[model samples]
Target: MPLTDTDRGAMLSVIGASSVDDLFVDVPEAARLSGPIAGLPNHASELAVERHMTALARKNTVAGEVPFFLGCGAYRHHVPASVDHMIQRGEFLTAYTPYQPEIAQGTLQMLFEFQTQVARLLGTDVANASMYDGSTACWEAIGMARRITKRGKAILSSGLHPHYVSVAKTMAKYTGDALATSAPTLTAETDIDALIAAIDGDTSCVVVQYPDILGRIADLTPLADACHANKALLIAVVTEPVALGAIRSPGEMDADIVVGEGQSLGVGLQFGGPYVGLFGCKDKYVRQMPGRLCGETVDADGKRGFVLTLSTREQHIRREKATSNICTNSGLCALAFSIHMTLLGEKGLRDLAGLNHALAVQAAERLAQVPGVSLVNDAFFNEFTVTLPVEARPVVRTLAERGVLAGVSLGRLYPGEDALANGLVIAATETTTAEDIETLATALQEVLA
Candidate 1:
């Protein structure tokens, strides 16, 4: 039933509240918007609003309309038709977080399968249901390491994504922790020795990115050992999980925590967000982990089932004791990742990863043939940086006008950081074709000329 004015008034009277304004007495009046925002129309019919948004959307150029090569954190990978159809089967789409174990077997089982898949892919013992996205997952991982080691300092590699580093800095500032991050390295590989030198007794974790921001792949075995020797944890962040199929798993190298973005598996880029954060760690440290966890069990009837096993880290557990304020999982996106991975098993994932690498190499080689362009990283999976004679930003803008979504500019990722401003980071996923590579090369030649 729709609530009436009398119903609201009676409820407020019972609580001894005079009005809605009285309920917000604690909120500062100066901080609140006085009325409707300026410039925006006061109100509009639902149909009119839909029409306006639709018209605006039509004016924008979508990835489907062009040969897309832009991949920094998000990639343009092919998702199977069956996976999409299976996820929207009403049972999966219309469900909420599986808080009730008995009635939520389906969701719990899916999350359990997801955790298993992530654990296997990352080569870790356990994984959570999911987190907000890759950046937050990295941030949480630093905190997790601190709690486990009872230390206050974190050492971050410069090759980590700028946004991820920024998030970590913000989180550390709030917690009164110390963070030492390296300056951005333009070369392909990370300086493991330099990273280890920064670690001290008070260091809780050493954070490094696999297939880092510049698309340089680091083995991370030596650095992981150094952290362990120093009584610190190694938090490995993988922005592209697909890179794992070809590269060594972080766990094999003694990574205490492995976090990544699972968007490449099943989720679409969807502008910038709604991506899944992949978090996995050793079984021993599961209690210190954030977010929800699903486990296998048997009911009184002796039937096998899945249930929410560990949930002591959310907001409901009291702010002071809670591991994190993150209460919900990116259930639907995680389901998409699981569905896609299930469709491709182990062998299929490896083959797909190989294809992406080959495609990227082909693209990089072709672009290198352009008079003034050169590939920066000799060791990369599907994404690599290119040194352009001219600044990459204006060239990218010109290519967009020519209907090719070329690649992301390094300047965009590191705005005032001028050293990398001339370099362009290009990615080629399984979706990229020979023709796409040719188109990009041609656009660069023309734009540079």
Candidate 2:
């Protein structure tokens, strides 16, 4: 696939570069590699390539292979065998975007079901088809709030995931929107009071995370009331959707828009991505919500049918008028989520959630008793933070080397921020075992010692 000399010369000429190296003029010379990667061949046999890749893969200490406890946004959940089998069926697997509703009845209907389930799960009036992921969906919610409130300032709760906050700040810089951000403290308390006080006439929305990034749960009703009083919207972000099974939904708390990552359901962690984003909001803000929306209606012969009711994106409409500019989404992942939700149903989901909470409580209680560790949440569902006497980053690495995935350290989330250096966020789901919790505790205790 290498470009011909003519191709390379012609491309370089068009870009006003004399050679390929000229294209990298902006890169720092010290950072540039002097030669190809060591031990990596420029070319290799097909079998050799596959063998090398397999070797690299085997070196990874996968989540399931270890006593896993890692969780900040992504989670490790069990996916039913039937969920994968069904999605792999040719009819569902090969299908692309459902542009033609006539031929895409199955896809449309699945999306309709997905939307319904998400709406109910988040306690919102309507939910979109899907989005890129939680962070992008969050930024979209902020944009929607701006449109509705006619304001450019957004107050971001310190408890919000740092990655989500980073995404909002990046997008806001280009859109001329102002984002109010602050680093989270390593404490049991949330920053709801500060967020409420930050709401003002210029504030478009207040984004608060449920059971937040630190896995601390707090009531958002007062913050919601404060936003409403200032004509601003309250956008609640949920990173752990499974917690909804045991706690009140943001929509019920009067949050205007609710968004979250749906990876905890059927979408088992696939290294990092592709994860589905869940977005939902009140009926009044349906028009302003981004991404796709599927609606149910009867076709010609009095038969129930589904259609793409709203596709407010640049590709589907005028770029300037479209509600969102998101080019694509995780359709397959969304399908997996829907299938898993269907299999679990409402009662099953609640039961599974209970098991998760039970295991988490056991794990949290056990982990807290370890010397040099202290639990940092007054309330939580499946995930919570625990502070260590020493910086958690080294402890996490030491535990990993000992065949245990302890947890996510605040040092990793907020680099160079010394205040949160000792904070560690841990999540325990149904997959966690009594032995696994014990393993993490013993390993962590030894590492600290």
Candidate 3:
């Protein structure tokens, strides 16, 4: 696929660019490398490369190796050994698109189960196989709203993760969708109330994050009702699906679209990726759902069988009829998620959720007792915000040096927002231990003092 001289000239002509360097005009001059990367050779032996990578990897502090407490979207949970064992089987691991029903029954069946589990977990009439991740899934949902409502403007909740908002803004810039965005607030006003009042006749959708980035929870019934009244869709984003086991489901609250990250159940943090996005919605919008949907039917002999019910990607169907040009599931990650959920069952998930909340409460209480620290959330599930007397970013760095992987800092999430510079967002899960909580509390006190 490497471009020949003629091919390169043709591409440059099509884009109205003179040279390859012209394409990088948006990148800052100082930021771009002038020459070869320092200390990196143009060529190396396989053994040498392995050694170099190993040395670099050893410098990173693995979450499980220390007192870790970081969770904004990706989380650290106890993924069972059986989950890995099941996913690595040759037929499952090497599987791809299930186009041939006769030869791909196993893959189709697994996806069917995954879809069913996601629907019940998210409390929706139906759920797609999966999407890229939470952020893309969120953008897809907004696009779906525009298709369903025939409007151009989408109002984003202030509490929506800044990362997700950034992704939406990037997409809206090209698609001509009007995006109304704002920075996060530390005030008493709720995003739900603010967004409900912001809805208008031209609004296509309202996007809200459940147990939003700062880890505060709110009721969505009123907001959903308001969106319906305004002829706008209510899109709920959940960064932590584990919260659903304890809190009310967004679908139950009448959210038109419920999409979230499925990393908490069976997937590893994996240093940020290969995470699955769980997307579900009311039955009325199933046809517009992105990715793929697996369906069940009986054969001529009355034997149950599974098949791909729908695939709206332009690659699969005609371009004009497609809902999304780039829509594909994170198959391996979704399989891991499904295996984990099946193992947990219904009651087990609730019990695991309870343990997470209880541990989070204990950690929050202990952290709040630190000098010059105050709790920011009165209600949260497995995570909360704490305001420190000093800038939390530096304190977090110091804590890391001391072998305590403290939670994410709001300053890190909202880089230049002076209003939230001192706030830190911490998380807890079943993997969190009493000692880990105590270590963070004690380390935080000393660092602040």
Q: In lDDT terms, which candidate is top?
A: 2
lDDT (CA) for every model shown? 0.88, 0.91, 0.90
Summing lDDT over every window of 10 consecutive residues in candidate 2, give the lowest-scoring window. 89-98
Provide the global lDDT of candidate 1 against the true structure: 0.88
lDDT of 2 by residue, 17-94 (tens): 899998788999998988999987798999998998999999999888889898898999999899999898655663
lDDT tens digits, residue span 95-188, model 3? 3567788777777888899999988888899999888889999999999999999999999998999999999999988779999988778753
Q: Supply candidate 2's per-residue lDDT for 388.
A: 94
Order of quality (lDDT): 2, 3, 1
lDDT of 1 by residue, 13-59 (tens): 99999886887878898987778799999779999999999999987
Per-residue error for 182 in candidate 3, Å, reads 1.4
User: Which pairs clash in the backbone of model 3?
Assistant: none
| Candidate 1 positional error at 266, Å | 1.4
